[model samples]
Target: MDALLERIQSPAHLRQLSPASLQGLAVELRERLIETVSKTGGHFSSNLGTVELTIALHYVFNTPEDRLIWDVGHQTYAHKILTGRNLRMGSLRQQGGLSGFPRREESIYDAFGTAHSSTSISAALGMAVAAQLTGSQRKAVAIIGDGALTAGMAYEALNNAGASNCDVLVILNDNDMSISPPVGALNQYLAELMSGRFYAQAKKIGERVLRNAPPLFALARHIEQQTQTLIQSNTIFEKLGFTYTGPIDGHDVDGLVATLEKISKAKGPQFLHVVTRKGKGYEKAEIDPVTYHGPPKFNPSLGVVGAASSKVTFTHVFGQWLCDMAAKDPRVIGITPAMREGSGMVEFSQRFPNRYHDVGIAEQHAVTFAAGLACEGLKPVVAIYSTFLQRAYDQLIHDVALQNLPVVFALDRAGLVGADGPTHAGMFDIAFTRCIPNMSVACPADENECRQLLSSAYAQDHPVTVRYPRGAGAGVVVEKSLTPLPLGQAKIVREGEGLAILCFGPLLYEALKVAEPLNATVVNMRWAKPLDLKILQEIAQSHDRLVTLEDGTRMGGAGSAVLEALQDMGISRQVLIMGFEDQFTEHGDPGLLMQQYGLTASGIQQRIEALWPVAQVTSALRRVV
Candidate 1:
């Protein structure tokens, strides 16, 4: 670490560094980020892209004092490095270490905890309002990506803030790619505007000239504004009543700092559109950023460690299932809220381009869009992450569940996501989705089970959600076929004696291990919603102790479903619900996180040993039998 890096032990120390030194710090931070992330193989391009912008923000503004809200927080590694986490960079995403995203508890500099896309503007605006109401002199700055900016909530926030005259800064980091290649004409135009430097320089000169001179300058500025208003097509931000500034170069640290310093004191709802490269520094990442966006572990010196298609992921299973299902069913249509690649709908998009809908960072809109499509008799499969599905709760409840629409929600990354932290973890999907009236929830044990459950969900007309975890399964050889499993049925994977370990999703392995010492029976009750009564009754009658396990919260999860079932039946079954408690799972390796949360095979084994006495032997079995 250099002097600049050494000085930044915390955000308070950042104020000590000069602008030029801060710029140097940004370079070193980027080098550090690249070095660390390249080896760790996590969020390389996003962090590299935001280096200068991160430095400029800290240099121009008072962070921690001034609330800095980062939307879709993949771009926050630079901010983290600058905000006294420089030494802790190596501890990122590790167990008992730092997180990859902005956590409110992690640092005072991160004003809001963010993981989902398209939320910063609204959150920042709320903070701005709160600050004003509380008579605090803190400024609210929402650093959002171009992709996140496309969401309707950002526009809504812009509209409200513009009208309220809130002194909030909306920095649009346009990278031409948001995880994957950006779609729509607005993205293309922004790319064209940012690639060339002349436009920004000329605009800066015009602005400076307008600021210095008097009546004539004001008149010219007015005319210039009028001309821009007339000539330029109404971009999304401008339409929402924001004072649009730039398609500026985000990489130019000095230029950005100066512009921000100028914008910092400016009036209400300012939108600074800064264009950045996705993988700014590293050559390999710059060339192919999509691959490097959220790469797995690799050697920093060797670029990427293995070929992109070295092995199959659970996403691969979903992708194959999607294509196969589409081929089989004419009504099948695929939908993604700007997660075409992540959700494994790329082939579906290609094969059925007309049937495919990439709704661009709008989860609510996507859910409602699918609801509409379902009403028209199309089997709309909205493949989204469990974390992102939280954004469309009302739509999922009101639009689909009430009406009983046939929307198949393929929920990817349904459990504890590694590295991305609490924001990215899909732990709450079960708790939230279970309460809804007509929605059926499905959890698959492995890749094969995931495809089958997806197929089953597709066949249903009552709005089903099939959730699966990230990465590869237990290397189970999945059938190159789409076979719909029996809905609301639990499959008995094992039949033992002393204990019964009932589980949903990927935690079935953990439950199996916990059951091993107790000589327990293991049941993979694939569906959470229906709460397979047959299996529940059988286990209740036969087993002494029934332990429920899931990768979600214990409150309203798979275990909760079993308890609800027992309540309805009026039978007191010894159901010990074991899952992640009300607490949030932090950023770490999924295995380590699972272990920490007692969702690991070993962790479950220990917990079961302690809590295994929930069951009681019958008096008749002891005496008469």
Candidate 2:
């Protein structure tokens, strides 16, 4: 017989299978998921954990017509497979391949696109309200993890969703982990809710009621309502206007299907708590789900092995610098919004347990919390991703920058992050941070500069952001001493004639390569906020043409800052600004993406030659002469 997974074309096919056959389909789905991810490398444990739930959801729900939104969307591999995308699983996160997250453009089954966490409930509520307005019977369900529930937006949506009494269903997939182990009062409340005597008593009461009652619809309703009332007094969801159900076993496809069927017919907002284990079927992943959360391609039999790399990543440099800085200054505190592992703060967290704060997935609270610490004479370093920091823009401006608080923001993954796509890219950090008053932005060129600039930012009295790319840079040897670089200063690395390239961040290496062949002067503009006017004037006067390069967006970016400064300085040199255009970049290899965007060395050379053909010809003639 053909495999159950091979025969299924869509949810329609999935729904056709017998209740007994559904478990076999789940087994096949898990096998397929493990096989594909072992080769392609993606959200492993989360996707593995969601297999049974995905099966149950698709089996029970009408799908496509009935909207399904996956929060953080990393665990949607099974969802994709069931929705007629099994063959394309091989291309997951590859160049021009399937997105790791749910994208509306990818399929109709992906009702709402999500990469960032805690957005599903809000989006689902909006869709549910829309359905109400249109007089449709289609249901909307938002499946969010417990880690995502840490965000305030989820509660804000919950408050509105409850009061509105819409047909939105919020399914809490309580896996007891987000990216990091789940934290906060909510997590504690959930643990208590699951283990408390009330839940146990309610179960006994319901079971006893079911045994004695007549096999009628009214009796079933009476038992359900009675058991719910027992549990409702203890639940926060019930108070928020939701009919709370379960702390049920998510892996039991039969139970999930039965429960979902019952909930589907219920009126008003619904909150179902389903407990699942991360990396449920896989033994190795079950032991250490975090390491397997997003591992590289590896053999499933051997599991993931730590492969040593010669190159030091910027994340490592930051982590090392953080530990060193903390040792020297007792006032130094490290904080991350549930990205302690991602931001390279494991060592710091281990060494300074008291000072280390993982503020869950709340970006807004993290920034304000850092600001509050700074007010009390403690220096707080908020190590966060460039994209994630966008969530706390208002907190940054109002709490940190407005007060001129000395909060050092270590903006990791500051530029085009490979594979994660535009949602995770740090393209706007340069433009966004520079515009804010009292917020200085530093663009480090290499690993050594990253450490030095971090020190410099730390030394400042006001809020400063030191932006660095995702991976390793030019492999510059980092200095052991804690030394601060001069703030708002540019360094001229090379001197040549005809053209000068002002490079920012890690793109300095690419600029150097372009400059070598053209004999063009290269200046590493360290700061994007306080433009190096003295160096800009000299570069402008000495060179016939100027070019600005960065890894961020062209509009209002570091390149734009250069142009604005030149305009103010009354310099008439023909300047060409080069950076990412005003478009969201796609998920692909970083090197390939850079080449496609004309940000690589050869690509930069081609653009320069094309833009200034006459200048190139004149330079060639001069060299010949």
Best by lDDT: 2
Clashing pairs in 2: none
* Regions of model 1 farther than 4 Å from truth: 10-23, 185-219, 222-226, 233-239, 307-311, 514-516, 612-625
Whole-model Cα lDDT of every candidate shown, in order: 0.82, 0.91
**Root-mean-square deviation per candidate:** 3.0, 3.3
Model 2 per-residue lDDT tens digits across residues 326-443: 9999999999999988999999999999999999999999999999999999999999999999999999999999999999999999889888898899999999999999999999
lDDT of 1: 0.82
> On a 0 to 100 scale, what is the lDDT of residue 31 in model 2?
91
For candidate 2, the TM-score is 0.95
lDDT of 1 by residue, 82-179 (tens): 78787777887787777777888888888887777778988989998888899888899999884886688877777787787778889988887876
